[model samples]
Target: MNIKLWIDKGFEILLDYGPKLIMAFLIWVIGNFVIKLITKGLKSAMKKAKYDISLSKFLSDLLNWSLKILLIIVVLSTVGIETTSFAAILAAAGLAIGLALQGSLGNFAGGVLIMIFKPFKVDDLIEAQGELGIVKEISIFTTKLRGLSNKEIIIPNGSLSNGNIINYNTEGTRRVDLTFGVSYDSDIKETKSILMSVLINHPLVLNDPEPTVNVSELADSSVNFAVRPWCKADDYWTVYFDITENTKIALDKADIEIPYPHQVEIHKQN
Candidate 1:
């Protein structure tokens, strides 16, 4: 009610809280600057270490967020705020969310592991979860794959890491497996010789293993020969197509009878 009383009250308030406010503001500013410096250092280190782009970005973001949250808590504590209550609430909320999103969090953790471990990379042909394709991108939750048929597949990171992952392109060489059938009466040695001629003439097929063309099995209808060849990974499909096309022609030229499924009829049945 009195101007004198109001002025005195204002002075008292400033004396009590001004120092605390200044200190809190200073702490926040210093904390934010420190956070920036640390994040920058992290980015530089990651870059120098030649980390993957997706992993580096995710780590940088994660570090910045963690620093910011820590800065907030430190600033609040400086201002004489009780941070324990907030911390308790945060812990409870985190626990509740973690419980609800257990699978998602597992995937996120799996993604981090995948990024760190470097099982497969973009453009690599990988087989996982019964799906075979070229990896397009690796994200925090899922990995994108471009199938051989050009279909896009999104697979969960958890499943990808937890299950078996076959990286076909990791190595430089691959084996081409082919099976050909011939009539039981056909000359086995001649059939093998013809197939071996086909393999030896193919430019893409490697000769280190000597190109196995041996009698594999004898089915009820036909005898099977296993034709195995080693070649460059990139030439696998090419060699496969060429061998399939050439084998048929070579066998036909050699007059090897490839029998079809047929049944004999008996007139005595009548």
Candidate 2:
């Protein structure tokens, strides 16, 4: 009699909740598939719109997570949970998490601002916070930099957006300023001419602006000539290094002495 009674009670319980269980399971399976399809369609649209890579990925992730969370709530409600109470609990949890992750939120906001304003773009040589490098990638939390030394540097977007960024690639052309010192005895006119010859012979130097060579300063031991040469931004370094070497060689062959600080010593006659 006891076994028959227990079996009857079990059957009654199954009859009461079996449909709800099946419904919840169906919702889970079908909701997940729909979410995948929606995310795929959104990605395809983003690609067609030519959205930036970072922004497109961020939005897609946000939508995916949001949909998944909603799907969970719907599945729970299908299983006979009170959805109003569940939603209240979710709101409270979201507030707590938001407060806890304030810094990350700030970084996220900064990333958004960076993407919208576009202060710097990929491959641009920028200097900020004493780090000089080319912009590699802009992520949701950080900006990547490929340092001139071939090292990778990661800077948080929060500070990067607020800080001063010196972009060297803004202009198509840049002027290379070089200071060369000659001994006071060296003829100023001849020295200037020698420098001009170096600039004129270099193919990278632009002729439109006309390179300026002038005596900028007179030190106690040397006369400093300011050599300003204009070149395309891309050829700046090549022209800089080449002109420096060629100037030295030309000055040496022309018998012009490049001046350096010298300490003169004499034996004191006591």
Candidate 3:
């Protein structure tokens, strides 16, 4: 008799809880399907609108996960679980998390600023945070760069955004400023003529700036002339290197010697 009574009590418990369990499960299932559909639809729309792939994917995933969490909370509440205390605890936990990740949050904000303002893009050579490199990637917390020597550098976005950035590729053309020094005795007019000839003949040099060749300074050892030439950004280094080497050759051919610092013999009162 006791066994039968226990069995009847168990059946009553199942009957009372079965409908609630089924309803909770249905809510979860339906909510999950709805979330997936909405997320996919939004992603498709954004893609069709030519949105950034990374941003679209991130937004879609965040929305889906958030909706899933809300659905789970609703399901739990339907099963008679106390949600007010749970929500309070979650709020406190979120606050603590935010405080702990203050720097990361700043980086994230800086990253947003970078994306919006777009000071530089991938493969752009830039100087930021006392480092110079080509930008490799821009993430939520940091920007990655690969140096000319193949070294990898990671800079926090906050520092990068706050500090000055020199973007070498911002303009289509760049000026290559070179200073060449010659002996004090060398004819300045002849040297200037030779430099002008080389610059004018070079195909890469732009004509608008007119290839400035002027006496920049008189040093202790020699007289220096500034050679400023404008060329396309991609060809700046190549043109600079060629012009420097060729200028020396041309000066040598013209018998203009480059000065070397040395001590003069003032020996002998003895």
- RMSD to true structure for each model, in Å: 2.1, 4.1, 3.3
Top-down lDDT ranking: 2, 1, 3
Show pairs that collide, candidate 1. Answer: none
Per-residue lDDT tens digits of candidate 1, residues 1-270? 699999999999899888989998998888888889998999999898767677688889989997898888888888889999998998899899999999998898888888778899888889999999989988888999999899999999988899999998888788898999999989999999999999999999998867898899989889999999889877888999999999999989989998887888878754
Choose 1 or 3, whichever is better by lDDT.
1
lDDT per residue (tens digit) for residues 35-87 in model 3: 98999998898788654466567768878887887897899998878899888
Which model, 1 or 2, shows the larger TM-score? 1
What would the TM-scores of all predictions be?
0.91, 0.78, 0.81
Ranking by TM-score: 1, 3, 2
TM-score of 2: 0.78
Task: Indicate the residue-level lDDT of 179 in model 2.
Answer: 95
The Cα RMSD in angstroms, rounded to one decimal, for candidate 2 relative to the true structure is 4.1
